[model samples]
Target: MANIEQSASAFLQSRRSVPAKMLGLPVPDRAALMPLLTAGLRVPDHGKLEPWRLLVLEKAAMTRLAALAVTRAGELGLDAEKAVKGSAQFETGNLAVVVISSPKPSDKIPLSEQVYSAGAVCLSLLNAALAAGWGANWLSGWPSHDREFLARGLGLHDTETVAGIIHIGTAQNSPPDRPRPDVAARVEWVSA
Candidate 1:
């Protein structure tokens, strides 16, 4: 790697969310996106059970998702504004990948582990996009949590839940860095 990090902390500190709206045109093609997806799949899996699956939503699919959100919101008797907001991410995205937490049957491997693996995949996808010189954001809205929306809109099974919608595109502007968490306040020194 040409720009290799000298430290682990530096590697993590470099990661940040680039506003999806600030992203420009010309998203990654299928061939380019495949490697990113593959990289995301390489996450921690207890018992070697890959519990996460992704749905790559392009421009056309985004329109469908937005349309579905509008219709489903009416069915659920939610506010029009909320409905529109929920779908806006999809409608405006250059490209998106839906990380689904597909918890499968496993008596030994805990369900929590499966859910975590899915979350890990979400982070992996987001980081991969940033590393590839693309702006990416992991997001979720009311539609993701709503049962009708997932079923009627995204066609997600009951066993599957949407973890996040990973938006990817070329960054239009430089992102302003935000405040970091107070690590000292959050940490506790454990001495035996």
Candidate 2:
């Protein structure tokens, strides 16, 4: 048990998100991704509501979404830079998993908690992919938050929104570790 705890701590400490552009081919196939998805599902759900669902996008789907992003950007009168940046992920992605937050009508569990669970699932999926020897990054841009884009491109219901889009693929290079937060400054202990 101690060994397991130590290993988990080590993994958590070292986990880093690879840049989406740095990810390449050799993405996980459905068979290979199933176990990772299973791992991702093991997150906190206070009401057992399972207020999250995954949508896997292959290369072709990504291409389609990329085009949609550009069109939506035009319709919205966004700047060229914003449009390019927003659509870049879909344009270059080989495989991605869209973690959708599907809030359920519940009296006990708050909607915020359900949304948090969806965010947790996104992290779990990204971590699972990294642990499985694939590079993974969680990303969300203007396109993700735009209602029109979500409705047309993803077929998301009014109650459903994207929690994250996790891009997974083989890594081109090992990214240098960026500075981490000062945990000591952020922590406050309370004992009563």
Candidate 3:
């Protein structure tokens, strides 16, 4: 087999999240986005229950969501500055994938596990976009948590919730590296 480990390790080591605000167009066309979506579906799925769904928000959809954010913000009694910040992402982005965690009814698999699977899907989608030379950021602002926004904006069911909103587009500028967690301090070796 080819030496895939080296390339994978290098890619993981160099990977960084580009902020959504720093991302610009042209967003990946369906042809390019398909492979990323395929990769996202390849994550660890216990019981083979894909407890997640992706909603691609293009220009018009984003605009509608942005408008909803503004109205919802007012209804939620948020201040102007915070409301603007909440909707700014939708107002600007060319494309974004909203990962919805939709847990399925199961006896063998617990709901927590299903939730984790959804989270894994989010990370996988983000990484897939990054690996494909697109700037990707996983974000969830106040609007994502607002029930009114969820219902009116995205039509998310009560059992379903936003796992992440992954913005993917061309990067406006390269960001400087931020500090990483000290793994040694946080890790513990145990043998029993």
Candidate 4:
């Protein structure tokens, strides 16, 4: 196989999301994170709206978010068990990047298109972290959907919302591969 083709194929085949709970410390520092962040920005954006923003949360911020999650859960009348589970990420996270879907006012581009750009940014960041030898997982729990949690914890504007919360750290263990979708069954070929 050609060098480029072989490497790309191998990487795509081996890519997997390590569980956030299984991830440990030693996450990328600001100096080390620049390249990865740059790579993440290489995504499709119609109208150049760039309808997204990244919020990096280190240990202190993570701790604060976790506490806030629990408090917000109670105020929302969420079940105790679920509330605790939702707050676990904030308490345990070594590092995280919250992708905020901050859609812009665009007459040409639809709102859905702007939202998809944000989603793409999330995936791009996740992939960049994984490629840089970090254990990365894209996650969204009850707190992400809570308006009070987002506003109070992250200072997100009313127009902005969580697209994804990407957790990054060292890998404690490699999870076994799960079943994949049957592409052949899902695909349809069109003929003129």
Candidate 5:
């Protein structure tokens, strides 16, 4: 049917990313973001662990978070430029969703599988925002990788980590599309 074809095209065309700097907002509110987040929660879960969570960042918390980034970077001796860039995401973002990788302890489900599911959640969130006609970017800067930053800003538990930060907003500019990987190189045909 035409609908199936259209859906396929939309999925393919959706593989684009705009610069985080080029993003400004009118960020989606809780009421507005509910649908977008619900869509993301639909990602593939191997063991139904739902091993990820989202942290919504509103405009009010942006300044405090940015300042925390500055302080955490100093403590960690991270590059100043990188720290500033990391902070800028929160500083400028009108709203954001931090994808927290929270793996449930499971005997049957390996930890790696849960991690993969968290990663899938990130992609799903990114695409959902794009499909909804919002300018969205998924970022995980140095701060995300820093334990100090995670503790101070996100209060990430030992079982959890930052998978990605999905920044949603109105677009300041339409970014150019980058090239995609060749499918043939990345896939293999196996007849069972």
Candidate 6:
């Protein structure tokens, strides 16, 4: 048990996301991705209401979505820089998993909690891919938040929102380690 705990701690401490732009080919196929998806689904749920679903976007889908993002940006009269930033991920991505936050009508569980669970799934999926020796990153840009883009490109319902898009592929380069937060400054202990 101690060994298991120590291993988990070590993995968590060292886990870092590879940049989406740095990710390249040899993405995980459906067979290889299934286990990662399974691990992602093991997040906490207060009411057992699984308020999340995944949309796997392959190369073709990524291209289509990139076009849609550009079109949507045009319709919204966004600047060229914003439009480019919005579509860049899809344009270069070989494969991505869209974690959709599909909230259910529930009396007991709050909507915020359901949304949080979806976010947890996104992190879990990203971590699982990294652990499996794949480069992975979680991202959401203006395209993810635009209603028109979500409706047309992803077929998202009114109650559904983009939790995150986890891009997975072979890493083109290793990034230098960035500064981490000061844990002591962020933590507060309470004893009664």
Tens digit of lDDT per residue, candidate 5, span 39-103?
99998888787899988988877778999988887877879897899789889888889999999
lDDT of 2: 0.96
Candidate 4 — which residues are off by over 4 angstroms? Answer: none
What is the C-alpha lDDT profile of model 3 across 1-192, one tens digit per residue?
A: 356888878899889999999999899999999999889878788999899999999999999999989998898899999999999999998899999999999999999999898889889999999999999999999999988799889999999999999999999999678999898999999998
Q: Residue by residue across 79-159, what tens digits does model 1's lDDT show?
A: 979988987887888799999999989999999999999999999989888888788889999989998888877789999
RMSD of 6: 0.9
Weakest 10 consecutive residues of candidate 6 by summed lDDT: 170-179
Q: Model 6, stretches more than 4 Å misplaced?
A: none
- Across 30-95, the per-residue lDDT of candidate 4 in tens digits comes to 987888778877889999998999999999999999999989988989899999999998898899
| Separate clash counts for every candidate | 0, 0, 0, 0, 0, 0
True-vs-predicted CA distance for residue 71, candidate 6, Å: 0.8
lDDT of each: 0.88, 0.96, 0.92, 0.90, 0.86, 0.95
Compared with the true structure, the alpha-carbon lDDT of candidate 6 equals 0.95
1 against 4, candidate with superior TM-score? 4
Reference-based TM-score of each model: 0.93, 0.98, 0.97, 0.96, 0.92, 0.97
Candidate 5 or 2, higher TM-score: 2
Best by lDDT: 2
In model 1, state the lDDT of residue 128: 88
lDDT of 3 at 38: 88
Rank ordering of all candidates by lDDT, starting from the highest: 2, 6, 3, 4, 1, 5
TM-score of 5: 0.92
Q: Give residue 42's lDDT in candidate 5 (0 to 100).
A: 97
**lDDT (C-alpha) at residue 16 in model 6:** 94
lDDT by residue (109-154, candidate 6, tens digit) is 9999999999999999999999898999999999999888999999
